[model samples]
Target: MKITHYCLSALLLFAVAGCDRLEQDMLSVPDDTTLDRYGLDTLKLGDKRAEVGKQLDALLDKPMQCTPGKTGLGDKRKAYLLEECSGVPVAGEVGKLWGEKLSFFKAVFVEDQLCSLELQLKTSGDYAALYEAHGKKIINLFGKPDEANAKGVRWQREGDEAVLKDLGDGNISFEIRNKKVVQALHHKG
Candidate 1:
């Protein structure tokens, strides 16, 4: 009886310890190159609309309403916009990307899955400087862009693509898209 009791206690202790380690591993930050190709912190390219909404609920001034005909890609997209919602303030990993300069953020869903994320950054007189600063940060995370030019930079990996461009209107546009979803939309149209 004593041996059985001691063995059970030891097994329970080992199980608890293992669970702790697993939890820590799950919560730890991912490596720079392992952000699942293209994601804005917690928001990923293929997340469901409900999950994305739950994650961003605090930063949104009001509940995001899915609107039609906003994507201009086709009639099958539903878009949620945070236009001028910068007043609400953002925090965490998503906020660190562009910080207070972020003027707009849009998430487009195809068949209830997030297909794209678009962000607009409002700049002052020195758009170039702002673009360079943000560009460097993106490069550090995703490495050298596959395509680069005076106006923009693009990085493609697997089925995902990230583009950062100078809008030439005191704004910078950064977009991340899932190629498969986008291609399907175009094909349907």
Candidate 2:
């Protein structure tokens, strides 16, 4: 009787260990390099609108002020403005550099998923300095710009784009957009 009990206990332990190993194997991370590289605050391309909204709420720690559009791509998407970072009232170190002079962001989503993020400077300081500072920051994150000019600097990876544009007014635009969505919008237009 004692030997049988010991054998049953060993079998149960082995079964549990095997199940854990199988679970780990089944739940391995995906091999898509773009997915591995492209993400912000738990938000990523192709996420469902509801999921992105939840993440936005979690990141902002408050229900964001959202405006739904009635025309254009805005019809399929919603915009949220000026959201601060999660778990912090103020922007982080890097965010502070641009956030100080820049107004809050305008985050855009299509079919309920984030497709673009835009930020406008409330007051364009020395255009040279603003461009250089944010340009360096974008490069640091996304590698060298694919296109750089007086108008703007653009960096792209896996159909995702980042642009820092001097719109030639007090308004400076920093835009990150999903390339696929941009193409779709252009095609519609």
Candidate 3:
């Protein structure tokens, strides 16, 4: 009857409105917390070598050594290494990446633009325990990783990627890279 038709129309209208709201929420960009979770706010990928050098100089205990060579990907790259910069904090505001200590930090630049960052966590004993704990912490912050296995976990966003790998020793390697830049370089050659 007439009442049934009216009810059906009203329900359809409400459903459409709800779907629009949901779509908007899903499309919304992530906030600053996302950037902080991956240390992108400070050591952002795709930055120039000089810019990164200034940031590293402020955080590291001493100057890192830069070596020029070709990367495994066959791109001309510059790799910077800080071997003994333990306990040096890098991430802004959050500090020390959930209080885990670091043994070394590295930055790799392709064509003078930074493409990746690598950090090794320092631990005395129980490497697996520390790795599991850090993985849980990262999952809590960034949700489930895109890929995970016994040795590593990776989370990839639109233009960047973050990875946590178990080195089978008393350390874990955490790395972040710019996927867009890497893909572009690969295509160029």
Give the winner by TM-score. Answer: 1
Q: What are the lDDT figures for the candidates, one per model?
A: 0.53, 0.47, 0.52
Model 1 regions more than 4 Å off: 1-35, 57-61, 68-97, 125-136, 187-189
lDDT per residue, candidate 3, 1-189, as tens digits? Answer: 332232211221111123333233324535434554344445567777777677755545555666565433425353332121223434422123345566667776776777777777655445434433443344444443566555666777777788776675545677777776555443221
Q: What is the lDDT of residue 10 in candidate 3?
A: 25
lDDT of 1 at 61: 44
Error of 1 at 105 (Å): 2.9
Pitting candidate 1 against candidate 3, the one with the higher TM-score is 1
Clashing pairs in 1: none
lDDT of 3: 0.52
Q: What digit string (tens of lDDT, one per residue) describes model 1 on residues 1-189?
A: 232232211221111123333233324524546656677656777787777766655444444445543332444464432121122334422232345355666677765677787777656635334423443344445554566555666778778888877676655677888886676554221
TM-score of 2: 0.48
lDDT of 2 by residue, 1-189 (tens): 332232211221111123343233324423334343343435665566677766545434235566554223334553322222222234421122234344445566655666776655545444334433443333334544456554565666777877766565545666667887656552122
TM-score of each model, paired residue for residue = 0.57, 0.48, 0.51
